[model samples]
Target: MSEPEEDLQEEQRDSTKKKKKKEKRSGKKKKQKEEREQEEAQQQVDEEEEERSECVVLRGIFKLGKKSHDVLLTRTRLTWIPITPETPTGEPCVLQPGVVLTAGRVRGEGEAAASGRPAVGGAVLGVALFCCRRRGRRLEEDTLHLHNASAEHTQTWYNTLKELLAGFSSRPRYLKVFINPSSHKKEAVHIYREHVAPLFKMADIRIDITVTERKGHALSVMKECKLDEYDGVVCVGGDGSVAELCHALVLRAQLDADSPEKPVKPVLPLGIIPAGSTDVVSCSVHGVRDPVTATLHIVLGHLQQVDMCSFLSQGQLVRFGFSAMFGFGGRSLARAEKKRWMPSSRRREYALVKTLARLRPEDCQLSFQPAKTSTGNLFEHRDEDQDVKQDPESEGEESWTTNQGLYLSISIMSIPCLSPHAPRGLAPNTSLANGSAALIAVGNTSRSEFIKHLKRYSSSSGQFSFSFVETHAVSAVRIRPSSLINWSEEESEEEGDSKTTPIIQSEGAAFPWNIDGELVEIANEVLVRVHPRLITLYGEEVDEAESTVSCSCI
Candidate 1:
């Protein structure tokens, strides 16, 4: 072999080996880049999946009992993720806004209490009454405590939980309030600031308060209210305030419905802080006048629709009444109003005695349309058309019944009429939101009989079973004094001109109407119609079984 050929072949072999090495290095780099891209893509996918989780607003280590776990706090819930136990993470405990009553810091315990400095021990966060169902039909309450965090952080969690809880049941950023300073006890404004404002501040809610100076001031405020800027309306007073607010709001809704430039709006949800002579509406809705419970109910944004009785005369709405009583009850209320300015604690007793002394059965001409009670759900609300369809035969049928002699009292109640005055409620069988109102037409009876019937209300036995009283579930009622109507003239002629005495009195003698604890002017001819679910109140919704005893309040 020649020396030149050997050198060229050696050079060719060296260049080929270098080319192979370069190819191998390029392939290795490409593989590395592909693997890096794949890992990045997988990371992106994992983050996207986590986004679907109840996004962790706040997370930390929570010490529950002796065990510790990682925890997450959301707007409406708190979740625990255990770390050391080596157990599969399962469905987290849901702290429902409605069920979770309160969140606060726990007082020092054991060694922490023994120590002079509470900060030496870690802080604790506690939440009360986390209601859970074990057998699907029973309610179980549990309290949760999170320990081992710093004092400031624990407080922060508490405040955050409160803020989140407030946000859970409601989306109201601002509220419009009407406070009647002259109502019953006249502490409405004070009650509102003390009990209501703090919760609102914690919940980050803005309050626009109006202290009513005059009798009809609240009505005017509600009528001219700027509906867009408010989340809901709150009334701080008694039943009178509720009546005023409801009337104004319903009228506004009607006006908006008739307007061409604006859309008709739903009546804003309303909350009542009981601070009046009688707070039947509040008791019926909240089960109690507990300031904290009422405030929390409003903050949580719970709502229960209720029926309303609208009093109309001459084709115009005069007022909206949650409860009404005629005869001696009305007379008693009227007499009480006149004596209210006396300033004596015995004024009510004096008025009651005086009214009862001269009380007699009222001779009234009554006409009504019977409500459909076949479904056994007299408390359920139904539209007019639906009601008619359900009882087609009774649609246009009207029943006229006359109590020509006397009636001790006739109470028309939309709700159960639960109040401190009437503990078991005025109309115990009636549903608050049902389309029907109970007409408890109590006929004339002796004082002793009336007393027995009234005493029955204090117990759970009920007052309707008495022989002197009769009740009818009615959708609407038209009432006029038989002594003033043509029926009176017909009866007078039949009795002949020999006995010239009138039955009741002249048509000008207007009997006062006791409307929601307030005495109001009522004409001789008054028609009351029940508007089903006319107003929505901040309260809880119990099932039919629970509805009857929903208000165990004083």
Candidate 2:
């Protein structure tokens, strides 16, 4: 804490940063060198190389650093040809969407321009055009000043430049956004005010904001709201609100379709901004929990189709989301939901302790058909391969595996459930829209062993290595509680002529069903069906090799 010590620590931190920067620079240089060598050996160009040979719309001198270049804006990429008599225009410096940072028009002061420079300044006087180009990890501003140009010519070139940049997106100018005020941390409004609104304004994206006042408010709004007026639906809240909006949107789309047999679903993408305690869906998709980055993705108009799982009880749709859980996972969420009014920091701990103390696994019968990828060591036992043959109802694709046992938890995750509780994600290998859901059945085990397994979730360790844990990639699953059913009978001999009825009550607790962190009614049986690519989201598809690093906006 002394001044000298503080100075030393600060100097050390700065030195470390410098070293990291130097290492990154060296790595980038090496990669570039290898890339150039490979290209030369193969005599091949990049994918968009041929596109640059098309008609050059605009051409002029532009300044990059101290040097000038004759730039050409083609249909696909930008080419900067250095103006020099000695050196040939060897692969004209090419730039696509990835390297171009900020592309806009410049005004005021004039900069000296040589023939090699592209027209940077485009409007009225000076170099009328400017763009920040990426140099390794950093961005460098490059301006072009037209040495001699008329006002009309400048305006024309600027418009053309804008058009070129706009080609990256489908050009969605308008969108409808819903903000849930009572969601996790109560910061959706503040998040929008501080980050989302400003970036959206700059992008020239018109957003109609609606701050929700009550629960189930978004559901009603989506039911009655116009579907074709905007480019996409933006939900800013926790998993509950986002899931609610999705449910309502999907229902409405089906309702409004002309043909009930085969409905025409809406292709409107949904954008999720994480402004809640648990943004599992958003985090799972984007690989981060930042609100601005999510908003930018919407503005960039990235499209991804997401799978949806519909939970139905007695043929009526209860709810639908990307993920759901039964038994202990459900009970734990229910206990947690009670203390949602408290701070997220305290609520999680409170929920965990309270739920564990009263935790009791319920005996239930599960019937599910295994997905193609689920036939592994776990299915080696094959308890009910004969059960499938005996049951006439479960014919063809309905190869149900019936099992009865006390289970701690049964989790059905369509998307990877990522949160502080499960940092590496609950179902880490679950696909985003792979036409399947991961069914994890945690059999009854000792409290200490269960806690030990739970602790492993916080780290990148083997949480599924427990002997009691079993997982299957299933397309459809049905859970039937052994002791959840109820029966009532009326006595024939009543007092005088009146008939009396007696209600039969079960002594045990029912396993709570958790659907997107919200509890459904205590039902004896529940059915889940996966719908592949049911709705489009403003995120990329779940690639098999999804990188942990921040993905570039493509």
Candidate 3:
């Protein structure tokens, strides 16, 4: 073969190899571009899926005010879009966001139709939607009306909305209500009828109400009534009424379980409507002592589990309470209970003044088991090592710390007991369902100093900043008064014998203890044990409470 022919063939082979490499590179680039586009499309679909609406129940056209609008209903929300006049039959011009459905209502007829007024824009059928509108910490009712020419569409929308609302499992369907007509100015019945009852009706919750006629009437009713028929229990009264209900519910649960040693959580949630002189539980739970706010919380099915304290005296269950006070508080309440003929406000003021005038310390022995998890104590005047001590009696068990002193007042609270007089709560360091209680001991101080400590509760902070005040987060506490000593019998020896024995009596001497605003006289030592998340209350958890109008009595 010729050298020129071989070189030409080689050049041809080189050209063919270069052309094949170029084609291969071009195919690779094209495939990479297609893969990128597919990935982008998949990502877009995933984003849309994340933002997708819940199952759509109904969709149609309705007249809102003077213009036509497109409405969409789903399991979670109710959305509406405005239709421009130029695009009457086309898609909506503006797509507005939907309103989340809470405790709302839907009716087949609108206000205009009910009032015999002509429908706006000459529409025939109408539907009204009543929804909850939140304004800061308050909730208000709002209504939206939609008019359509087709009755079948309006009726379908109403039915679909009703079914969706009914599907919410958290909201209560039936409630057993107890109204203490004698609670605080004798207006509990009126408050329930005027403010709370209407809201319950609006939410379509069935209620069986019992107007309490006496002090222990509600407790008796709670003991005998069948709680299984109701979804929740509601009390309309002061803290005393609420405390009664809490005790009754817990006692009933223990009895039903046949385990008095191990108490179980109540089967139902409790709702409080503030119609009392001092609505501490309501204020502490709802952040405000407003009846409407509490009612709205119940209607919305907001659940907050709270810790409760079981008070046992001499190995017998005294009661279940959220907060308790001994020493000065108990004495003041004892005085106030004796003055029932006076008006409630006047009686409280008189009690406060009289108690302050005769402020004396009680010699008592305090023992408590500190919580395992350290919830930092508020205004701790001593070091942690000094506060905790090993119990010699229980060698390997939990250590128990004992303190014996003359204390002006001893307070134990599982929840922040917010009230008009004490906006920061009697125990400001405590929280709901923390498995611990705030044990505050105010050591014996001067009258001025004690008054200053008491008045600081109305302020924001520094209520526990006093040197004499000490706070601890404890799981259990035992309080025994050292002053409960009485001489029962004394025997005189014969002439010249000169021998006499004195008999010390411990029983039959009852001391007043202010427990959840109810005065209970208990004998012997009281053991308070905290149960974590023992009961469910209808309200949201609050970290802080805003101050209300302070009382002038203090």
Name the 10 consecutive residues with the lowest summed lDDT in model 2: 106-115
Candidate 3 per-residue C-alpha lDDT over 331-406 given as tens digits, one digit per residue, 9 for 90 to 100: 8898899899999989988989887766667767788888777565666574232233455644365777887766
Model 1 spans with C-alpha error above 4 angstroms:
1-59, 63-69, 72-76, 79-169, 259-265, 343-345, 374-405, 484-503, 541-554
Give the Å error, residue 193, model 2. Answer: 1.7
What TM-score fits each model?
A: 0.67, 0.72, 0.80
| Number of the top-ranking candidate, with lDDT as the measure | 3
Q: Per-residue lDDT tens digits of candidate 1, residues 1-554?
A: 99999999999999999999999999999999999999999998987765744465677776767767676765334566555433356655543221222222111110000001122343444332122222211122234556755666666666566555444434466899888887766688788788778666655678998998888898787778788788888888888888888777777787768853222335688888888765778878766655555665665566788888888776666777777887767777777766767653367677677755554566665556667652332333221211122222233565433333356788888888776556567787787776899888776667667767776665455567766666778788776766542211122333322211223555555667888877766656788888888888886532221122343221
In candidate 1, list every pair of residues with a backbone clash.
361-407, 362-407
Root-mean-square deviation of each candidate, in angstroms?
A: 19.2, 18.9, 11.8
Best by TM-score, which number?
3
Candidate 2: tens digits of C-alpha lDDT, residues 104-198: 21121211111122244544542344333322211233444434345555566566766665665444578889999877768888999997787
Clashes counted in candidate 2 amount to: 19
